[model samples]
Target: MNAPDIIDFGERLLVPHVIKGETQISAEVEHFSRATQETVMTPKLDLDALVWRRHEVGPAFDTPLAEIIDFLDAVSEALDYDKNSYLQEAMEQNARIGTLGARILENCYRDIATFFTREAATAEAVGSFGSLEALDGWHRQSIRGAETDIRAFPPRMVHILAGNAPVVPPITIVRAALSKGLHLLKMPSNDMFTATALLRTMADVGPDHPVTRSFSAAYWRGGDEAVEGHIFRSQYYDKLAVWGGDAAVRHAMKYAAPGFEIISFDPKVSIGLIGKEAHESEESLANVAERAAADVLAFNQDACACARFQFVEGDDEQIDAFCSALQSEMGKNTRYGDGPNGPVPPQEAVEELDMLDMLAPLYHVYGKPNGGGMVIRSSEPVGFNPSGKIINVVQVNELSEALPHVTVATQTVGVYPQSRMGGLRDALSSSGVQRIVRLGNHIGGAFGGLPHDGGWPLHRMMHWVSAEV
Candidate 1:
């Protein structure tokens, strides 16, 4: 039987294109509000063929950086949410991600331009290799009685994309293009449409463009040896960029061979730190609470960088006031108006927290316990993961007490009263947190040159080639 056609990026819907191999696998992809049945070709372990294709496409992408940036700008404009049918379909298909809403989706689509700006792209290239000249061509440097030439060469890359945010795939695409790497993206089940839509935009930009030919996006169940075993071999891909939960990270780690490397963006949690000054005046208290609410509800608290717990330096009454204000803020629309307003907490999570409220002296529950945004006041961090805008407000005499709870799993620490950040930064950095930002700005809207999870991803993704003479 002929394989069913899946959504290929506006190129063609031919069954032969959909299934590249003789053997085919059929599956149903759940698009939240709807489900679509599709078929994927079982991968043929042709390492030599894949590598040759990458090398063939490499020189074409070695165009001037300015031209590449211009191409990306055009792609970004094509992705604008105003009248893009592809983006609309992607938003609908990705709706099952739950935390995403129309406003958030629009922002994600619009932000693609930010990643590929001339300033950002230039900064990334320079930050990665020390100079754009190094990436454009080999640069010579003299050593003791010797000369060495070095260039930043693009590698054959396999990106195991995370489904947490729609922007992730586009960011990865920009990195791959800037580095001139041949990229094969493995789409997550929860977000199958984003990569396709972005790739389709690239196709629209130029069907025969080297950057277009160098890219391919497809889906297969992760850990399916029939697929991953063949592609994960070091002969085909030089690097595997894995972004997902612990299980996914661990699975990708197994495929890292001697010559090949794995760059893992593992699961992480975030928290907020409010100073005691928040309790000194009504205005201060209100400001801190609003900022805390922004951190907690950023991306509807679904982002790994979004703060889930707030450690406020205050007494009982002060803590109560902050919680009251937080509950109100969580329910109301914010600057990104009318987006997702926190999901309903799962019954198991609510039930577990309810039991804790009864037994634990530190636990004080506020808002609707079942869902619709709940805040728990506690003397220490709660054991369960707080979801659906359920924030744990831990009251402490001093902010230092909260440091013990900041473990290796912590990703970002949003702090209030900018003065306290200087003192707390070193401690938080040592505790395995990656980013520290002002309480209200933890969403990571910066354009580029920022290290994600404590490393420059574009730098790490490329292969640095040096020749000594």
Candidate 2:
């Protein structure tokens, strides 16, 4: 059979053992492929089996934390993409459905194992809750007149995952296992097979384990009312851990009834700020430019944490030099598995830059518009979003001038000089930026146990119940 036929024949969803009787209905999995700029259909799902019933909550909630960690560690060991047939199949299927290329996907799959280690799982539990004891059972505390016992109880949740990055599935899986929640992953079209591949790997390691049985992965059209309208009810799920574009979030909001809450990871943008100190010497300028390149080129600028607009403090001459150097640095940095030519920008965006280049002095366009990576410097922020390894370097008199441009939609800001961050952090926080990091550190520096989008997600994934005695 051909690739498409094989994909179509495989049933993508897992039918939990708790589910009894036959399938009431079935549907084809469908989604738009951003990679091919077309619609792609893959496999079928037993829709009735995807729904969670209150009485059918998996034993994961009551399973001891240490055992849960052990299960997760075993899952980590089983995710070796080279050895596992499920992941190897996922690698092949995802290459066709996902936006990322094969090599990048392999790297992401390899890194997924790192997050599932016992050390990492324990850290997640501790970071989310002050004490790991909270997840085990109610811990006692005293008030002025009364004593209270509080526990972080798992809630039945549905994670509407995004496909921009392939690592999201494993991230959600880790969070769900740590929180001991009943999870139903609504896989995105761009990359549907990964979550199912992960769960299948876990099943191999622990077939009868609670954590293995706790997860269910499926893909339905994002706004399919017949499917969503039924499972999105408060009776079926307590929380919806949503992540996607604006339309996806809006669709989920409609289902946010009295009891079913939405923990939204809204679509966001990131920016960079460079202080005047960057121009104190040629070496300094070179160093900052290289750092700036790392931020823009990360995940080929597809990540929300990747900086799109950069605010620099310097004269037009100084800025031009930095822009030229930044463009050169972007071409050299391919650590994120970018092609030799780098990411190709959209033809429309390149055309806009071409027009801007004709009006020189007002706008400086450095590097080729091709996948070689380009830097566009303007006195004001550009009108469009930058991607395809493109970075918009905006001129600023001082780093503080960039503060007004920051908004709630801004997720991260990478500052050039370490000293400048202390002064701007308060204003950046007030303006709604969730994370602030030094230049070149956007990829590894801003993440881990930290508040994401504006909140601690692990905390939000569970219900903190208390009883006064």
Candidate 3:
């Protein structure tokens, strides 16, 4: 892979440029961060120019929906990991700016194309609007006394992308194309290159295409009031699609007014619920352990969907055995993780475990901080966040007893014994859990037209306009 002009100076990293629509914005503005002590040089953003004019927005909205799909298909071809230059650049620079390892990051980048498909694109429109015809043009519907024609129009949006998952860039790009919206992506500090790399790939496919010209990706510090104060108003952008991080979402909320709406994918937690049936036999216990391990190993527990907390129904001896089995199973290979011994837990988590170990009978720690997965069987929930293949298992009298821990911040709950889900799903949903899945199947499809972070974002990204005659 031929690397870009990005320079790493041990202390300071220089990102070569930013993407402004089909144009490449060079290093014109230098930003210094006192927090990270890193200086970033990118093109100066013309805050006024970021907003699309009435005439420019019209061309994008009028572009045939099929044409936009074709453009996205071409983009999918450009993301091929074996041949795409942009992804190659991403693979090279990801280590300095990303959280995942080289092998895991490559696996994610390769799957980028799957996120863009006719089925996936149209499905989001259908799922959001009941029919694809709503996005193509006005669809007339018969009413009791009056006939109404309704259509979905794209809104001008600013996508604040979180870099936790590498595939987010393509997801945002496909959604923007499908909705036919004007997008200005504010790149996060962790993984800044992928989004700009994607826009550059689109420009290569069709530089003058309306879709390509309707997109831009750049970077500024997240809370820079000077830049955000000007661009976040309703006059400049209609929607703010903020992803990940509590601070990012809170800062974006300050700009949300009556006309400007914030579509937030806030930070969330996921947990696993195991039934006593798992202990029906040694084999049943082993199977449950394997499934629980896979959920914890997802992105080494960095992803929101990865199970960090677990509630189990078993006696003290049985629960202790399950923890040991779970830690052992996590050492084996899974789709999201490879080799033996998973990543080590974060330092703070390890310190908390160490402090808890002194409590003896009240708390038990399985597996060490060195790696290979760790489980903290606690009488109550731990305070520190769980990460790096760590799972906190709390024994519960019944699965529903764990309901109090489930809140609006809970994104997914993986329950054991498929039949148990039928009993717990309603209560789980009412308690603010958006998704409930079979114990071993916590990871699901990422395509649109699906429930995400509690709402349908594609539907939120559009302006539902109606006319009556």
lDDT of each: 0.71, 0.79, 0.79
lDDT of 3 by residue, 1-469 (tens): 2334445544555554444465454666666532244565666777766667545654478887878877787777777889887787776666555666777777887887777766777777677777766688777888888899977888889999988778678888888887887888888777767887777777777888888878878788888888888888887678999997898889888888998999998899999999999999999999999999888887767778889999999899999999999989988866666426457777888888899989989998888887688889987888877888778999988988899999999998999988899999999999999988899777755576776777777877998888997
TM-score of 3: 0.92
Question: Which whole-number lDDT from 0 to 100 does residue 78 have in model 2?
Answer: 81
Tens digit of lDDT per residue, candidate 2, span 1-469? 1111133334332211112211111324445655564555544655667766778866687889888989889888887767777676677667776667777777777777887888777877788777677799788899787899988888889999998887788888888988887888887877767877777777667777888777787667788888888888888789998898888899889888899999999988999999999999999999998888888876678878888999999998899999999888887735563644567888999898999899888997998866778999999998999888888999999888888899999998998799888998999999999999998888765124667788888999898899998
Give model 1 RMSD, 1 decimal: 5.0
TM-score, per-candidate, Cα-based: 0.87, 0.91, 0.92
Stretches of model 1 off by over 4 angstroms after superposition:
1-61, 96-99, 335-341, 369-371
Q: Give each prediction's root-mean-square deviation over alpha carbons.
A: 5.0, 3.8, 2.6
Candidate 2 local lDDT, residue 390? 82
Better of 2 and 3 by TM-score: 3
Q: Which pairs clash in model 3?
A: none
Comparing 2 with 3 on lDDT, the higher-scoring candidate is: 3
The positional error of residue 160 in candidate 3, measured at the CA in angstroms, is: 0.9
